[model samples]
Target: MSTSPVHLWGPVRRAENDGVRLAFDALTEGAGGEPLLLVTGLGANRYWVPDGLCLALAQQGFAVARYDQRDSGESTRLPPVATGNPISALFGRRGAAYTAEDMADDAAAVLDALGWGSAHLLGVSLGGAIAQRVALRHPDRVRTLTTMAAVPADVSGLATLRYIRVGTLAKFARLRFPDTADGAVAAGIAVSRLLASPSRPFDENAARADALRNLDNGLHDRQAQSRQIGAQWSGPRIDAITRPSLVLHGQDDPLIKPTAARAIAARIPGARLRLLPEVGHELPARAWDTIADELRTLAA
Candidate 1:
């Protein structure tokens, strides 16, 4: 298989609600008819949408668009950490301060900027949370929904070792080495380790290379990561999503547990859930084919 990275680029587009501009990459041209919008997870840029996955989806006749969430990739960042702690904003007693609803609005604004009235939506992890909110709040903008390794609010015990390790390491690394390139390298290594699975080992070297490439590409904007994390909405509100949906989760996922996926599937009316035993929190290269197949099936 060719490992050449898919080239994607876009100029910033200002969101209508706020002046926040979102950076996105679009893979168009070969798509037969349906357009797919991919929302990435926290701390990750559009590159997290694996190249193989994108090519597979493209081959299946879907124009795939993946973008950095606000505060992460090429997107806008929130106010400085001194003004407010983004993490605290999400978990405080104010009941999910920013909320996934706002994120859904942001996704809608992206589609509007693209001149697409509606499209298929796919989100991973935290991105899935935002996508769910989008589907619930703006059903008219979504043709179908596919959430992978995502959970709803009120769903506790959703963290995996990968999540814990990455979160802990990133926090500590930032505090100790804030202004150094080593900090970024260390953080990338931690994420790479966390994403690797024993049963389905990923190419750590490749992951590291990609991590560095992503960082060099100006895609690793830390402030944006904090903002996206701060904007999360937790609880059982996923029941309101009435669109045709598919939830994919790895049985061995260390971050959001499989049960979280089950809960999300249960709440969504007529949603389909698929559990893969060999996969993990990170989508391994080996499993791209299976995931792509499922997504194509759902899109069809």
Candidate 2:
């Protein structure tokens, strides 16, 4: 995973994974800090996640780098693994273009680009699954593991049903954001309202602005996301991860049940599980401080 300096919009960090080019942004101001890689989930763009959250994590004596995984955000969009809808790719109906292991290797390449030998890894949902793979395949490159909204390799039908509610399932299946800026804003607001914490007020304007920026900067490809969803898994490797770990889940997560978090905690040796009350699929501002504190202790 070697990197060459590239300038796309600014000083965008770029790396290659299995013939795919990837882009990323770094929070490197913290001197002598450990590298903390933030992995976004599914079709999510790294920029969509507020920089303030990354900064807050950086302030905890770690250098943070959040990146667009291949196929999402500004990263390279490889050729389609299949011929049809991205969702079909998730099931390998056509034949997968890549597997989850390929994506996991991509994360390790980020550390290589930063010239860091090892770093703490954190991920959300699908990103969390990739992080677990990174710890298993490249153990020397991972210092600690933290996951939010992630489930175990072998998921239960009950856990999967949480997201199958009529409204949630319908909205998720028909997710669409237009290319225009206005369209982006509207889509962002809708997505925010859908994915945001129910206990917290929906910040429509904030979501709009974030969506606009993401649309302007990151590339959204349904095929890319679907291929990732459909990617092949190596095995049940979470139990093989030896690093100190933390598993954070929203008690009220509508997409994935809290039981998934406990299942994950049970597999990894010494992994701590913290289920936040009033939290949803997305981590609200209130939980960020608490999560940061937990990460700090994990490093300690």
Candidate 3:
């Protein structure tokens, strides 16, 4: 069996400003649908969204573009951040080389590279925050905005939202990324089971496969995640987003309280909210259709 990751995503490409400055990996696929950009959450890995979800969106007439953000997945790594201790990063004390605004700029650059004047932007968790920034900064590039399990600003300030789950953070801190591929799969299974919706059964085998794919790419840097978290927490309120918007949250989300979704809906003028029963922070395979249907309605 081949461990190579490139085969999964055929015809990988990179988009950037002049001379590979701020360059990142992206793919534009699907047909007969409007242009849509799917932004990944904190991990910022396009692969994390699951191939099935992307394909479903594409099948629903969305010309979907998926990509990785800086210091994440296969994208460019900016200056490094501390990792061994993982405590400073836990508090988001680590300085980041870039901000969520910077990441949003990368998304706009991606649109320019793909020759798209604008596209519907759908983001999950941290990616939702980035999408909001993209709409605020480059209004012309976003046709519609849909955010899932995301907060309007930093995780701490929002009384209804949570900044971080300390217990989960401690769990990750204790985990050591094993050297063997099977070890990586096992590790991923363990984490997925923990993050899966309490109302549903987690598919350990599928989680293992996805984890193995991500592991083949590289380990996520905790410091980089800290910087992203910092930028997200430090944002000016997203009251200026005038784009037609949809905010979806799992009624049973543990990581991000459902109240956070309500807070975000209240902040963005003319935003619609949908609460999925028994859904959690992670998007279960079964929930993809409901999400896609909402996107279709939003697009219309």
State the lDDT of candidate 2 residue by residue for 201-272, as single tens digits. Answer: 777776665665556322234566666666777656578789888999988777777777988899999999
Worst 10 residues of 3 by lDDT: 18-27
> Which candidate comes out best when scored by lDDT?
2
* Candidate models: Cα lDDT each: 0.67, 0.73, 0.70
What is candidate 1's lDDT per residue for 66-88, written digit by digit as tens? 77676666677556553143344
lDDT of 1: 0.67
Tell how far residue 288 is off in model 3, in angstroms: 0.9
Give TM per candidate.
0.82, 0.87, 0.85
lDDT comparison, 1 vs 3, better candidate: 3
Query: Which 10 consecutive positions of candidate 2 have the poorest summed lDDT?
Result: 1-10
lDDT of 3 at 235: 53
Q: What is the RMSD, in Å, between candidate 3 and the native fold over all Cα?
A: 3.6
Instruction: State the weakest 10-residue window (summed lDDT) of model 1.
Output: 154-163
Sorting all predicted structures by TM-score, with the top scorer first, yields 2, 3, 1
lDDT of 3 by residue, 1-300 (tens): 112355444465677743233333333346446888888777446766766666667767787777777766667766665532434543545465556667788888888876789999999987888898888888889999999988774344323225445576567556655557766566567656656788877677777667766663333345556656655335556788889999998876666677778888998999999999878777777788889889989999
Question: What's the CA RMSD for each of the models?
Answer: 4.1, 4.4, 3.6
